[model samples]
Target: MKNDVKEFFDNSEHRPPKFGVLQGVKVVFSAIEVAGPLGPHFMAEWGADVIWLENVNGGDTNRNYRPSEHEHRNDRSMSLDIFSEDGMAVFKKLVKEADVFLVGGKGPSFIRKGITDEFLWAINPKLVITRISGYGQEDADPNYIDRPCYDGIAQAMSGYMSQNGTPESPMPAYPYVGDLFTAMFSLSSTLAALIRARETGKGESVDIAMTEVLMRLSTYNMVDYLNDGRMYPRPGAKDPIQGATGIYKTKNGFLFTNILGRKQMKTLFNMIGCEELYGVGDFKEGFSFINLNWDKADYVESKVEAYFKTKTNEEHIEIFDSMKVAAAPVLSFKDVVEHPQYKARDMWVDWDTMTTEEKYKGVNVVPRFKVNPTKIWRSMPHIGYDNDVILEDLGYSEEQINELYHKGVIFRNDRDK
Candidate 1:
């Protein structure tokens, strides 16, 4: 984390001192929506020179979209309509010079634009091309292929959403869950491909499907079905596999805790002064206690909840820490930002924000390295905020850049608006 943090959001292009794992890598990010942008965003965090390519029309739709004021926006944007003549020239130049090109779109649309693996290989033989889509390019069924889908749709298709919530009314996870899974998956694979390409001098094109990646994430459920023909029911906050692992209500806030084995169960039974409950009614192993006596679940839950209610969140936390159990308060976004736990862990940092001009603060980068930890040096730029500098670096004359703008081929989203 070694950038001149103050100079970043301004008009400077000087990279930070710490070149993270992906140093010297140039990425051309041509993605329309969230899932597509995240790969490059993460690479940017890891010290990649990401030339974020937005659309000439309105840029990435996220610039025009926001769930709410407090929601964490991932700096959504796009640049240049590569279909335009002048824009295509610049795009081709970028491809010829770049190491990695990550393009996000539907299958048909990518083919329609003539943005194929072969085309990319022809431009830069050593470049790694990553293609992200809803279903993916290789889906044999045409009915599902090239179909437009997003986060919620992926969750629904992958059966991840079905495993959520209670039996009464199952619920979907927040929208970003599916997209995030796809992002990390795409980023890691792209990095692997990039490494191989650098060594072999031959590029690789990858196709990542949002639905497939998320389906793989629900491997826990898949194991039960594969091994024992048992499909887990919707769990909500409780373990769908039926373990003594859940969020319990405390006097102040909720406490999330887990008991791994019967030894811990014995400790819990003794702690609650219900030792007779241990190994009772052939409840000897695994989740047999709850599964065999489903009717008594409320009674047992009430007893546990009542015991927890005797203590506050802090007291429970101290006790749990002493007990060597995994537990924590179910914190909200605000609580996370202000919590001492996060502060001690160095998970938050102060920085300028892209959405607003005022000084803002939020999270630290993830996938931390002990030597060169990734740093959020600059806030993501406004639409074409670095057009002059970027074009200058690409050897484009000011006149040529102005001509491109005049021809409606490369205008910023906020031009004379």
Candidate 2:
């Protein structure tokens, strides 16, 4: 019986099969903040093995940005002082093994630290390196590269803030304008470089400026201004592509409706119990009543607003559904959490936090995959938490790891204590 059991155990599966889109790819991330860190977060979600490298001190400043109670406990921290010789040596070794390198620091700082592109490329010629900055690579004035900037600065320079908000009520846009888009662009470039490497066995450097990415987002407006010399004024909730599409205050919150053409206008009119307006001369097919006469918009909008005020959002939804009109309620954060559509689509997920006893939840995963489903592997790690494990994976022995710790080449909580 013992021999039979032993044989069965030996024959059973020893390791689970690897089944991820980027199963075998390895990425070494030395990025910080949203622009740098988000790149690896995306790559890791897609199944790449990403090792985050941090300095010997506390870690990236972003870790302190609104931490939940649960994140403090489970995350491991690593300390590597890159300014020191031993720290640089360890980092260089890690770069040698990495297929992709992502950095968000400026070129001058990297050059000063001896981690320049030339040095990194020399270590691994086939390495896909992405460098993200506030401004860009070219600058006629030397002081341009020296200027420090953040997401808001990039947004202002790239015309994103100017296009957002209304002409009368202009305000600052979201703070993460360039950072988020820069990460997406960097990831795209990295993937492209990876594909090129697979085909030609050569890699290239991808330089992404946050301002440049933000500028790309405003290309349509730029083209309009360049060709027609007409700067577009800030539009409110109304869409430029489709007229009579805007947000209206409902009984509960808000509702977005688009009654652009005669067909949709007729459907809306019928839904609102104003069926007499459908066959009117001004509402005829290709009449251009709303488009040609601006004053008609105010009259139509006032009637639509008054009609919408007669019913609750739920009632309006039912009416729209029955009429087959394109309409939806403007959902708030609280409403979104309890929304049936989000629940049905499995869009929101809960991640355990280490900062407190109670579990914390956030929107970490987004809806993309349908057939082969994937889950959140872990919440964002604490500062340098995977340091020892990563070093060990790099073939450093326990004794050597300890020695590096004493030399300030690595960091751990117990050592700090």
Candidate 3:
């Protein structure tokens, strides 16, 4: 209560010498896995004062996974038994000063735990309480609202999986798109709510459902069916309606081309020695020749395939560039890391992990800002690493802090094993 936030920044060793655009904002997030924690990680990079609340049991389950290193950075970890009386007291004090609080799990679970919006708004009137879940907080069926779900389940339930991969077998998008997309939605909504809260002096609660986010993303795929009742067959890696937009084998490797515009389509038809196909594109001024020749899809693709087989990757690149065709080589992971464009953009950066002191490389702060630029001032932290400093900031003495730790209200995980 006595600690001035500005004064702490001026004196604390943890403070970065140069902060980001979110320097004055405070965010406290209690998240379990990737879906919950990743949202706040971006805010932390942008200089928000972020505290990650971890359960005393063993901290976030993500800590056991590989991507955990990338998921948690620029955060102070505080392991606490929030279900306990003393722990809730400490949590309430922290929430009293926070601008945003994000939590992950079913809505019913939090309500059962008595951590509802009303309880939090009583502490901080302008707080933006954000909840991340699989199916959101409400539904026509009460049973569905409380159903436990994860990334894959959301993908399957949201129709996202049905539209992906081949018709033979559909596959879920890799690297947890369900979780990451939901996190992105949650971040945007919370920031919007925070802005309104600052202006009108009233808080907002944002409920983000992973399934809903995926369904929204699939709008383009669903619009045709919604209006005309047409369900096109899955085209695998190819565009559903555009025959010329697909991956083709080159002399050396594979290249994907999306020949949509009239000029690009004409260039492809002429180059493939099928100039007669160009006349088929008389539908409109901006119509694509390949699209108009949909009836001759097999013949057109065969010609294009034969033409591509005559050229190497470098030759195809030169031809595409000269013809202004939208095409690129289908790169592998190694090729991506060694790509010249990524290096020129300073995409890769190095940082040392706090606990292991091990060096790691990852992408830098994205969509670089020209002013008050974001930065990675610190790497991932150990569980409850800043317990002393954080408690001290809350006006707790060293003796009281020790007693709290002894009483199991404060906790830390030493992953020495």
**The candidate that achieves the highest TM-score relative to the unseen native structure:** 3
Error of 1 at 128 (Å): 1.1
lDDT of each: 0.71, 0.65, 0.79
Query: Candidate 1: where are CA atoms >4 Å away?
Result: 1-9, 12-18, 65-78, 280-282, 285-302, 353-355, 413-417
**lDDT tens per residue, model 2, 1-417:** 011111111111212123346656778767667787776666665556777667766777676776322222222234677768777777777788778888786545565567767888788877888877776654514766656657887787778778878878655566576777888898889989988976886777887888789888888778878788767667677654334567877787788976555556666666556566555654564442244234344566667777878788888878777656678888878889898977776555455443445555655344354443333454555555566677787788999888987887777654342
Order by lDDT, highest first: 3, 1, 2
Best by lDDT: 3
Better of 1 and 2 by TM-score: 1
Worst 10 residues of 2 by lDDT: 1-10
| TM-scores for all predictions | 0.87, 0.82, 0.92
lDDT of 1 at 199: 96
